[model samples]
Each structure stands twice: as C-alpha cells, then as structure tokens.
Target: MGKTVKLYVHWVDTFNRWVGRFAMRLIFVMAAIMLYAIFSRLFLGRPVNWVMEMSQFLLVSYYLLGGAYSMQLDAHVRMDLFYGRLSAKKRAVTDAFTILFVIFYLGVLAWGGFSSTEYAWSYNQKNYTSWAPPMWPVKAIMTFGIILMLLQAISAFFKDVAIARGRPIA
Candidate 1:
C-alpha cells in the first residue's frame, strides 16, 4: 500500500475506535435511565414520561455509533460454514469482494439518513409523542454514524486488497 492509503486507514481506524468507545459508554447511561424509571414507578409511584423514549434514543445511538468499531474488530456476523475453512489470503479476497455490497448498502443508507436529517432540521420536525423530542439530533447522529461505518468499510476493503496482494497493511 502507498503511504497515503496507509495513513488514511490509520486515521479512520483511530477515529472509529474513539467514537466506538464513546458509544459504548451510552449503554451505562441507558441502563441508569431505565433503573431510574423502574425505581420511580415502583417506589415513588410516578412513571417518568420520557424515560422509555429516551432509552430508545440511547439504544439507537449506541447501535449506530458502534457499528464501525464492530466492523473494525470483525465482530459483525457472517456465515461461517465455508468461511471458517478458508486460508487467510482467501478470506481477505472474499472479504474484499463482499465488502463492495456492504459499501453500496451503506452508501444508500447514508443518503437516506442525510435526507431525513435535512428534512427534520429544515422543518423542525418532532416525534409524535407526549414528550415530543426534536428529531434532528438523532437523525444527524444516525447520518454521522452511517458515514463513519461507510468510511470504515472502505478502509477494510483497502486492507483486504493489500492482504490479497500479499502485502498486508500493518
């Protein structure tokens, strides 16, 4: 790989790692909110109106934001039937080929997410709920996360190409 390609990979990997770690912390926040909701409803005899909605928001954030990191770690699910028996180089070749479909899928997803975010921001859209939180923030986050995942997928493709070429990126 060229120096620029290596640099791009390094930078994307580093940024995604940091973002993924940040996303991981959201789980704790979600848990805490759920616990508070449970406690308030049972002991205080008062159900928090926004707790469930907020928890769902946190979950969406966690899943979207952590996607790239999961990809980075190769933690995403795959069919292991024939894949498990392939040699490393063969696996890299397979990954490089398969990731093109993933890249295309993510590209479409990112486009839709960006459009949704723009609409939400422009129209000041709000959820049709009692709490009625603004939708732009979550939509923006979703778009950002999708873009990050797309970048990571590209990076993985590059790495896989290098591996298939017998010059693996370190």
Candidate 2:
C-alpha cells in the first residue's frame, strides 16, 4: 500500500502556525491603543471610535488565530477526568478517538466558515459603519483559522494511532 499524505491538513497546520505567530505581534498594537484610549477617556474625556473599532478587529484576529495554536498545544477546554487518568496505551486510543471527533467537528466548521467568507467576499463586503473597512478579509481569517485547526487534528489523529500501535512517528 502507498503511503497517503493528508496535504490539506498539513497546509492547514502551516497556515495556522504562520497566522498564529503573526497575530502575537498585534498584542503590542492593542496595548498601545488601549493606553491611548484610556488616556483619552480619563484625561481628555472622549474615546475615539477608530481606536475601539481597530482594537475589536485586532482582537477578532487574535482569538481566531489563537484557536488553532491552542489546539496544537492541547489547551482547549475539555473535561479531562477520564482522559487524565488513562494509561499510555489507553490515552493513545482516547487521543485517536478524540482527534477523529475534532476532525469532523472542525471539518464542518471550516466548510461553513469558508462558504461564509466566500459570500462576504463575493459581495465586496465592508463593515456597516463609519470608517468602513473590508470585512471579507477578516472573514477569510476565520475560515483559514478553522482549516488550520482541522489539519492539526488530522495529524494528531495519525500520531495517536501510531503511538497506540507502539510505532515511531515521523
């Protein structure tokens, strides 16, 4: 039998890593804006809409991008009572099953998210407010983030399978 590669999932991992790391830099930007907003509100007695809006946008990207990273590090919220107590072999089996479930879950999310992104892009969508920026770009990030999560799940599924079988993983 030929060795099969999950290319789509791999690409998802690559994309997720890139975007996740890139999003980290935005923290500084958000902090700077936050300081400014605080200063403006506390001293100047006024808050700028653009700063608030931009912060919201940056936060959206930060969280979406971090989703896959959290998955990569196994940091997502989960009930771990059974998972935490399992033996190595049992854990591997559970891991495989869990990853499989995530694959399907994230698969659907990516599908719908991508379609949503496409719909927004097709209409040349923009935020319905002053300083209207194109929204499709942000939507695109959402879809891409989900895709990366799905891909990481696939690779993890294979990893758990290999571990369960007492085989070395590549």
Candidate 3:
C-alpha cells in the first residue's frame, strides 16, 4: 500500500471510530427520554407528545452514524456458510468483489438522502406530528452517514484488493 492509501484508511477509521462512539451515547439519551416520558405520564398525569418520535429519530441516527465503524470492525452480519472455510486471501478476494455491491447500494442511498435533505431544507419541511420538528437536521445527518459509509466501503475495497494482491494494508 502507498503512504497515501494508508493515511486515508487511518483517517477514515479514526473519524468513524469517533462518530460511532458518539452515536453509541445517543442510546443513553434515548433511554433517558423514554424514562422521562414514563415518569411524566405516570406521576404527572401527562404524556410527552414528542418522546416516541424523538426516540425514533435517535435510533435512526444511532444506527446510521455507527454503520461505518461497524464495517471497520468487520462486525456486520454475513452469510458464513462457505465463507467460513475460505483462506484469508480467498476471503479478501471475495470481499473485494462483494463490497462493490455494498458500494453501489450506499451510493444510491446517499443520492436519495441528499435529494430528500435538499427538498426538506428548501421547503422547511417538518414531521407531521404534534411536536412537528423540522426534518432537515435528521435528513442531513442521514445523507452524511450514507456518504461516510460509502467512503468507508471504498476504503475497505482498497484494503481487500491489497490483501488479495498479497500486500495487505495493515
């Protein structure tokens, strides 16, 4: 691997690690919100209208933001029926090929997310709920997450190619 490729991989890995850890903390925030809702409804005789929707948004953000780090950790689920028996190099070769499909999927997702975010921002769109939060922030985060996942996918492809070529990127 060239110095540039190694640097790119390292930077992306580091950034995703930070973002993923941040996203992980959002789970606790979501839990707190839920608990607040429960306490308010039970003790104060009123339920928070935005609690469920806010929790859903947090959940979406959590998974989307954590996606690249999951990929970096090789923690994503896969069918291991035949894969488990493959040699390391063969697995690298197979991963190189399969990651193309993932790249394509993320590309489409990013495009759609960008478009949605643009529309939301242009129209000042808001969720059709009682709380009615503006939709642009979450949509922008979605686009960003998809793009990060795409970048990580490309980085993984590069590493896999290097591994398949018998020059694995450390």
lDDT scores of the candidates, listed in order: 0.97, 0.78, 0.94
lDDT of 2 by residue, 1-170 (tens): 11464454456567767877888788888989999989998999997667877888788878877778777677788887778888887898988887777889898999899888888889888887787888888788878777767777877777677778887255
TM-score of each: 0.97, 0.80, 0.97
Q: Candidate 1: misplaced stretches above 4 Å?
A: none
Q: Give me the overall lDDT of model 3.
A: 0.94
Give candidate 3's TM-score: 0.97
Q: Candidate 3: where is the Cα deviation over 4 Å? A: none
Per-residue lDDT of 1-170 in model 1, one digit per residue for the tens? 99999999999999999999999999999999999999999999999999988999999999999999999999999889999999999999999999999999999999999999999999999999999999999999999999999999999999999999999999
Better of 2 and 3 by TM-score: 3
Report the lDDT of model 3 for residue 121: 99
List per-candidate RMSD values in Å.
Answer: 0.9, 3.1, 0.9
Q: Candidate 1 versus the native: TM-score?
A: 0.97
Question: Which stretch of 10 consecutive residues in model 3 shows the poorest summed lDDT?
Answer: 5-14
What CA RMSD would candidate 2 show? 3.1
Report the lDDT of model 2 for residue 121: 85
Task: Give the lDDT ranking, best first.
Answer: 1, 3, 2
* Regions of candidate 2 where Cα sits further than 4 Å from its true position: 1-18, 39-47
Which candidate leads in lDDT? Answer: 1
lDDT tens digits by residue: candidate 3, 1-170: 88999999988888999998898899999999999999999999998899999999899999999999899999999999999999989999999999999999999999999899999999999999889999999999889989989999999999999999999888
